[model samples]
Target: MARQRVPEGPTPPPAVQKLRIRYAKRGRLRFSSTRDFQRALERALRRAAVPMAFSAGFHPHPKISYANAAPTGTASEAEYVEVSVTERVDPERLRAALDEALPDGLDVLEVVEARPGALADRLQASDWVMTFRGMPVADLERAATALLEQERVEVTRMMKSGPRTFDVREAVVSLTASPAEDDTCAILRMVVRHTTPAVRPDDVLSALRAVAALAPPTPPLVTRLAQGPLQTATATVADPLAADQAGDGT
Candidate 1:
């Protein structure tokens, strides 16, 4: 005899779908991938008594989606996650409940109803602010000049399956370096493609390193600047891959 599938009842009236979360990754935890955070958040939601929609299967789980996962060892003041709920709860109350269960470093800033459209749909690119120690202004300027003058910068590497090439020139919307408060350190403000072939802070660090040496190595720390649609406010966003020529290392 074959096992028969149990029929589920009619779906409940569509309670408005919502994903309530705003976060910033800080401290050593910046090294944790987005997937790890997803598990952590899922646990937190269940502990908070937040109701969630489950898929129609034996091993179903609450539907939760994260916008973008920040790179490991990189701190980000701006991060976001989307979640679904069947019951409407006061934003403040929901936030408070989650906060009590959330660990330190993972701050719950807001629980606003996500505006229409998925985050991936709304996001055009990400801004990254990176700091490197022991880099002088002159050398920094030279590297920037070399990188920008080029039409495109292609960085090659082996992926999960095989080797691949990526164009980062256009991916970098804007690249600016400034003196950090530490003086010996410099900061890079950049906008990169948020999509797959996703440019990372390490990529930028490598670019600068290729032109000039960076101090205090060992997987330099990274921090997410922002994730959203790019606009007239700065460096023009273009497909770095679509760009004509790419430069050294990456």
Candidate 2:
């Protein structure tokens, strides 16, 4: 009788550094749920040979923390995650490696060494761009006006408990409509405050429908442009990765 020999390799080093990453979900990958993306990221980290940290327990898991995940079925350019790694790798190099490892549409845009303070707390609001196909721009503009005039717009969402109604207007910091490709397709840009339940793009669309009877022939394509501390003076969100990028000089 003969026993098969097992090969042994050096154990992975402990994760001592935390790196924050900004990635995108585009095209078909936008349909992937949070769980689906998490699994994909884990696989990508392995494939890219990212020295990710693991928890200490019977069932050890990677020390990856996702912050402010955009809702499923929506494309985004600013999705963020903080990953603990054993070695200190250059952020740009890490970004390139992960981008190459992951699928095409699920792109890794930026990677930065995590700074002090919570990423969630720094993110006060989100800038969303909604594209409406086969919908008049004028109708969307009118809807925005109508919605702004109203003090509150309530919408019902099906929660774990049951259907819960909340005011969508109170969460809206600013909403404006403009032309996209043509008159039939309108682009709506909105900066919405992060609320308790989180008012989504659909919620704002529902409010538009209630106000000015604005409806699209097809489902609107929604993309989150950015999420960070909102500048009251200019009405824009500061780049969450700016501080890290500045320090890296890349």
Candidate 3:
């Protein structure tokens, strides 16, 4: 016979304010995965005395939600999360408190009272900057040019379920290679749409290798510069926090 389920305990206090936060994962901390970040966030919340609201259940978890988390081992400047609190708190103060509570390299950059819409709906694309050390900038430029000329660039990756093949070129909104600051480095910047399986920077790199045989000696340093809705005319991504800023009259 199946075991009977236990009933939920009493509901916690209702949330009075919901805040959206923008944070950065920099340096060594970029290696931390989503699961690791979640655990750290809960610890920081408790240490900082954040008045978090809890779901009504026997095992009431904090009402925290994450969106568009960057892949592990990649740094990000525009990661976002939303949290419900039982009491009102100044966004800036909360930012400072949490920033101090968390370890170095996982910094809370900004916070705003959440606006009406879902955060995921605002994240249509991401801007990424990839630095390949010891690679020639001119080679990257040539590869980027060839990539743009192509209608589709198919690449394969192993998924949790199985291996999958997809065209990384279809999701690329913009691609460009920048002049290196130093002789030993090359940097490529790209804006890609969030597709069904989501084309990541590594996938694009795989396509480049396939088409142009451009390969870095070591793993490229990847950093997400921004993430938000794509503006097709300008080929730019609107800041996801714009609506929240307007709501706060900032």
Candidate 4:
């Protein structure tokens, strides 16, 4: 067998600093797949002249880590990623540059120097809001009540291996329904704990259908409002990057 030669060169420098970014997916950008976002981000980094650290290998890649990205079709205001850079850069400046480089709907909202702990660990829960048109708030309230009354809501999702079923009721911390301003639409706000296999908004919708026979005439528009540590008492999500920002004395 013939041996392939490895490309030889001086190795890339070790990362000097790490920055965590909070970005938003809105409008049409919510439909972008994770891989699409990755490609766009890499191009934006290049255009913004970020000093990204590279992996030491024949096929070197940027040192970027994504944590618990929202499902492709759902919009999110709190998607997170961490990046390592060879040179220290001002977080605000980087945020501005990256926001300008990327398309309008994929926005960089905030950036902070990483603190001591893992970013993923801080993401303990998510707050989601789903809007349904032509659905009355009274019907939604009844369905939410039924879903909460259940001991368990088992839902199935098709995985790569096969179909798998799990109880989504335990993961739901709180669920509430309200009338939208238009009076013709209904809105549901829920706080769900991040769990194994990750219960999604769609799974909850399925559970509602199974439990209360509530079905929207049109597809519900779902958006994740926040992703961070869960406050047990209030059933709310706190800012994940607050600790890192505190470390910077900002």
Off by over 4 Å in 4: 1-7, 248-250
Query: How close is each model in CA RMSD to the real structure?
Result: 7.9, 6.0, 2.2, 2.2
**Candidate number with greatest lDDT:** 4
So what's the TM-score on candidate 4? Answer: 0.96
Instruction: Evaluate residue 13 in candidate 3 and report its C-alpha lDDT on the 0 to 100 scale.
Output: 97
| Per-residue lDDT of model 1, residues 1-250, tens digit only | 9999865665444446575477777786777677778777888888999877665555555767776677667898768777778877776777888777777777777676655444565467877887766656566666777777778677766778898777767677777778887686767678886657777777766665554454434344567766766654665443211111222112
Error of 4 at 50 (Å): 0.3
Candidate 4 lDDT over 146-195, as tens digits, reads 99999999999998899999999999999999998878789999999999
Better of 1 and 3 by lDDT: 3
**Whole-model lDDT, model 2:** 0.87
TM-score sort, best first: 4, 3, 2, 1
Cα lDDT for residue 139, candidate 2: 82
Write the residue-wise lDDT of candidate 2 on 1-250 in tens digits: 7996644554446887889899999999999888988988999899989888887645578999999899999999999999999888888899998898888889999888876666777678899999988887888889999999999899998989999999999988888899965465789999998898999999999998988888789999999999988877777888877766566422
In model 4, what are the clashing residue pairs, if there are any? none
Point out the higher-scoring one by lDDT: 1 or 4: 4
Q: For each candidate, how many residue pairs have backbone atoms clashing (under 3 Å)?
A: 12, 0, 0, 0
Candidate 1 residue-wise lDDT at 89: 72
